[model samples]
Target: MCKNIQLLNDDFLQDPYRDYAHVREECPVYWHEATAYWWLTRYDDVHFALRQPQFKSARLHALFDGIAPERLSRFTPLTRLLESRLLLTDGANHQRLRSLISTAFAPRHMDLIRPVIRQVIEDLLGEMQGRTSVEFIREFADPLPSRVITRILGLPAEHYEQFKSWTNDIYQFMGVSPVDRTTRAEIASTAAVEIERYLDRQLDDCAVGGGPNLLSVLKSASEAGERLSRTEIIANVVGLLNAGHETTTNLLGNGMYLLLTHAEQAQLLSHDRSLWPSFVEEVLRYESPVQIIARQLSEATEMHGVPLPAGANVLLFLGAANRDPRLFWQANQFDIQRQGARHLAFGFGPHFCIGAALARMITVEAFACLSKVWRSPRLAVTPRWRSYPVFRGLVDLQLHVTWQ
Candidate 1:
């Protein structure tokens, strides 16, 4: 039954939670022949797999090395960039990169940025005033994070539009089922070069007595005896830019979709604003922005009585793990009030998302603002989900919102 699961197909993209539920029940540890990866759907399996030393994130370099030269040539730049990203490395290299980058992304710094995030949200909401219908993704969801992240990174406000485009291109190359790998690679490579150059200029500027933003903070860390090379700095800055906005954008869009569809839940939260944080958590569990996380086996192992060979690619279905009935009561049902269990939306263990705090802050503020301003917001049209296999988000979320 698991062998037949087509994760990249339209049916799966349209409705993966239902399929994942079926797979989790029938075969928790399933091998996907099409993509040549093992799919782990159960909560315990995925939770353990993430922290297991044998399942490594840095194996992509080895995996790509075995592919045909012609096929691999196009991905050279992307692979190189991925190799540098903290998310794709392991062991000492991963630690070094993560530690250096962590300074700029510290929780205290994120808290300091809260006021600015609130202002950004306010400005975005202000634009929607007097409007009966608005496209949530473009008007609110997209710009809020994009603007905030750009400001945090010290990038000029004028480049926000370009930054969004570049990040989208980069994500396409990194997507689970990208449309036309050749095209995506070209766009991603070009964007990579341009973004790196931009970061280089920022680094140069920060070298002369740093300023207030993240780039300056990173520079301070570098000057304070950290062994961060220029390439590592560029890689992390690019990583932060891409990782910073995309997931949060999806979270906001997916959250709104959940709220609008579950009108009772929306009304409940609107009246009681204190539930916004819990509502965000439930939205993450219900429709995780990132549907899957990849790992590669370092050695032969048996998981859940199923034997897996060495060098095997593994896909941890976070979307499924979050919905596993064993973990949460009424897992399939979206309940903002439910609490206790932590979801894998920001992932788990050592490689947990560094931007989780910032994402949470932005989401809490966004929801708080929406609940206060928007009255009886309902879906204007059926939400169109993006077709990326690993990302669960709406392409456009049109809502008919009555201003309070």
Candidate 2:
């Protein structure tokens, strides 16, 4: 079957959900010849595709092998950093690392961080007080989690500035050719090395000092008397640091953007007050930051009536799937009253995001407080999108708001 296809455009960054909706209803699975990758639309299809463990995630190493092994050998250091953790691994290795990180994210520890979290949030708002115009992403969205992460990792707050820089650098790591990738890759790779080395020293101290933090908790993980290696701990921390904040930041930013645009939805939540959590969930379903996720096929499997051949790369268009007309009523509309928790934004099955609960809590608290206080909020300039195949959301958003 021939399906009409268009290459990913810059406009997708500004508003991708709309772009994905049209594609999902028209062409469920579209193949791009130039990119040599298949793109799948429809949320339920993506959900079922991800649920199959027979389809391997670890097969994504091809992303970096765009160059010959000899050429990429020089950039090995950078490659290693990006490919770290359970995020880059699959099967039992992924499970083991996830278990260690999950313990730190337990209900008990998240509650422990709540007060500090609120104080940090208030401190951010304090800085923005009386400013008639503010860039929400710069002032609020980007820094909140970086600040929280530094404290969670037991690093000093001053380092949050550098952490933000390093994370931003890492964010730019994808979608470059072998040469440019090599250049930017070094800076990001060097930062990853330094972070791991820094954590190594901290982990050693926690082992001896018995400090109560994420590092301390992971240090105590065991299986048949085998503790986590320094590399494994670093990988998990990198995974946590990357996962812990950035998506939440986008979720908050994207959700706020939606509410501001859809005044009725915004007003509904504003009036009810108790339904903020549902609103957050709907925002995630409506316009997820992670628009696409791809897994390489290790064996033959069928999805959406197409057989995924062995060694084929399959892309799950999460945004498309979320807006699937078959699964959601008025799927394209942003409805706060939408029921069910079947959205794949946080993923599903084994690779589901471990920080979902923490993310939801932050969004609820931040939006509730901002809604109550901020007098007027409007888009300062049109939010921009990244020029990459992945990560569909605003790269730079300027929202002007006033809080008297």
Number of the predicted model whose lDDT against the real structure is largest: 1
TM-score versus the correct structure, for each prediction? 0.93, 0.90
lDDT by residue (1-404, candidate 1, tens digit) is: 65487766888888887788888988888877788788999999999998888889886554344345677776666666777888888888898888988888787677668988988998988888899999999899988888888788777778778877776788667765434656667778888777777778878875333233888877777778868877777777778867867689999999989987898898788688788999999989999988898998889999889999998889999999999989999998999999778899888877899988888899999988888788888888997788787778899988898998
Which residue pairs does candidate 2 place in steric collision?
A: 42-321, 43-321
Residue 90, candidate 2: Cα error in Å is: 1.2
Runs with alpha carbons beyond 4 Å of true place in candidate 2: 1-4, 17-19, 75-84, 174-179, 207-212, 222-224, 382-386
lDDT of 2 by residue, 1-404 (tens): 54444446656545666667666766676666766667788766787778888767785366565545666666655566655566667888788767776887888777777766687789999998888787887789877877776676666566666766665666556442345665666677777777767767877776423223666767766332565677777766766777667677788788878877898887788679998998988888887867777788778877567666888877788777878878888987899988865778888888898878878887888888888678768888876665554555567667677774
Steric collisions counted per model? 0, 2
Residue 76, candidate 2: alpha-carbon lDDT: 59
RMSD values, in order shown:
2.4, 2.7
